[model samples]
Target: MWEYTDKVKEHFLNPRNVGVIEDADGVGEVGSLSCGDALTLYFKLDADGRITDAKFQTFGCASAIASSSALTEMMIGKTLEEAEKITNDDIASFLGELPKEKMHCSVMGQEALEKAIACYRGETVPKPEGNIICECFGITDRQIEATVRDHHLVTIDDVTGHLKAGGGCGKCHEDIQAIIDQVQGKPMPIRSEAAPLTNLQKIRLIEETLEREIKPALHQDGGGIELVDVDGNRVMVKLRGTCAGCKASQVTLKKTVEAKLRELVSKDLVVEEVRS
Candidate 1:
């Protein structure tokens, strides 16, 4: 677990502005391209153009969730201008401090807030425009280059966590790996030397496995699994339906599916479960 500050722990445990507004004046969604974190913000405006209410739903790590919660709490009752001025620094300050590495998570919340305010004011939030680079998180060449040059990104995952480009769908992993290779002037391997699996190939294998081996067994218990990614022999998967919050998930992963994968694939294959 992350060594969260008091503020982060407080907000996370009793997260403020957690639900959605029925008659929201505006809604905005921002997701980090690298870190697999996403947030959706909803707001209700008053007659005086003050933010009457705000809420957020976050899908990410602790910092991302806590940042989104803190951002919503800070924006409530603030005027549009005031909310617009709320920076990443302000958010981090509110939380006392955050891990330097998790600073980007707070920044994501600030960016989302800005986008939400822009949407409320009928301003055009500029869509990322540049050569496509990281297909996983839809990160552009400009975003990657800027992050590399300015932020001193040392690894592909670091770039992904900051920009959110190669953190999703797994389609851009190879491209991102290539970019990291170019940036470092040497290859940095994110995957092992196992035979690579294409999206289609992985999908087919997962579907076949689920249909023939896993799903039928899970159906009996009203549980299921979703295959998220296959990086070399490292298979990333998500528990879904009933299996998600089940207490026995670890047992299922370690004793059953992971065991089967290791037996079928390379013995070196490692199965990792992602918490949603």
Candidate 2:
């Protein structure tokens, strides 16, 4: 464990507003259990559209919980428009600076707050442009690009320290390096054009995408899913736990699950449910 500031320790030991607002005006959820962190933030608005109360439910490490607690404390009393300006850096600053490796926790808090505000405004979170980069973490190219450009990150380790991008499997290191070089105007290495992926490679990518993207989102809502079969471009899966009998299970399969697979894997891929 890296050194924790006194404020981090204080918030971790006694977190604030650790429950739900039954009739909340906005709710935001982010992170995933598969990645070892998840957060759900709730806030209520007063007559004047000011945040009157805020709460959260989080499943993560000490840093994540502390960052979330700090976020709620900071969100209360601010208007939604005002709260929109809060950034991950602000969350970490409120805690007197989190360890670099734990900066993603503050990022998650900021995302949840943004999502909650979007829900309040009846707006869906637009999918950020750019493909997925870190398969193990479900981080996207847009996310890494913004993080690098915003924070002036220079190394793969710096990106990982702040975004958890290259911290898993190590396959994304080269891609990350290219992104870093591109962002800083450094000359990127010349490379041959890529060949098509083998069947085995596609399977591996599908599994990683599920682990990094799909399952975690399902897990967020007390539901779960498992890969049942992959034949040609058809992907079959079975819902588990709370998702098994959900009336919207098919919607989850098509909209959330299949859409993600298509976006991350191959556009021709189709997702179908296999009840078993």
Candidate 3:
């Protein structure tokens, strides 16, 4: 259920250049079918070293196809040097804005362009060197580090949204978190060095987090949260207004409410709902 922009939808529904050039000067292929996304870029350069034609064939969701189409269009009329300067952020910016979770689709376009340029120059394409950290998507530690540093990612979910590293199975979440901390220069807490929280301290922090961080966000969507009770590490809450019976309430509770509480209060904090 990604909210795609009008431009994204247009390119996806009717891609501009959807074929290969038999005599392309540069051909770059990236991604994998197993990952549910792939793209191939073709470009023909004129005698003046300016790209005269660019085309692409992409297999993925609407955003993926749109990103590929947009990339090819952008490459047309640019010199190789100019095209090389294009980044994933630039592609997303060109399309106005992409949903956070679909940002990786633009990353794929960037990788394909690099590979295509390497093919044109007859340079050796570097292989992935780091150990695999996310098995579900075959993401490597080197990939994670580069993405975290490039994007200035701060949270595990940000990494997930950008690279989908910790979105499946979640075994690599701790490793992803560690990389985020290193990139952001925030040290991960060591259990022995961490200060213990009293019951009163935990309760007060939870209340403050709900008031300061969670409620304001919910209120924007015509929903709200009421802190019902606190027992040990458990936080009982009641959904009010529109959120009370919304079909997406469970997702809100887990991904939004519980996630915020755990991030601000304690890692072991659990959130539950109380019915009348």
lDDT of 3 by residue, 95-162 (tens): 88899989989999998999999999999689877999999988899999878765656688888878
Cα error, residue 2 of model 1, in Å, equals: 1.9
- Which consecutive 10 residues in model 2 have the weakest lDDT in total? 186-195
lDDT of 1 by residue, 80-186 (tens): 88888988768888998877668777778887887887877799788777888765455787767656544445577777656666665767777666666555443
Candidate 2 lDDT over residue span 1-276, tens digit each: 679999999999999999999999999999888888999999999999999999999999999999999999999999988999999999999999999889989989989999999999999898877899999987899989878866667789889978899999999999999998777664323322355557886787788677656765677688878887889888888899899999999888889988887777777799988986
Candidate 1's TM-score reads 0.53
**Any idea what lDDT model 3 has?**
0.87
Better of 1 and 3 by TM-score: 3
Q: Point out where model 3 deviates above 4 Å.
A: 186-276
Q: Rank the candidates by TM-score, best first.
A: 2, 3, 1
| Residue pairs in candidate 2 whose N, alpha carbon or C atoms collide under 3 angstroms | none
Q: Show how many residue pairs clash in every candidate, following the order shown.
A: 9, 0, 0
lDDT of each: 0.74, 0.88, 0.87
Task: Report lDDT (Cα) of residue 42, candidate 3.
Answer: 95
Highest lDDT, which number? 2
Please give the ranking of all candidate structures by lDDT, highest first, separated by commas: 2, 3, 1
For model 1, give the 10-residue run with minimal summed lDDT: 184-193
lDDT of 3 at 117: 92
- Check candidate 1 and list the clashing pairs: 32-164, 33-163, 33-164, 33-165, 34-160, 34-161, 34-164, 34-165, 137-165
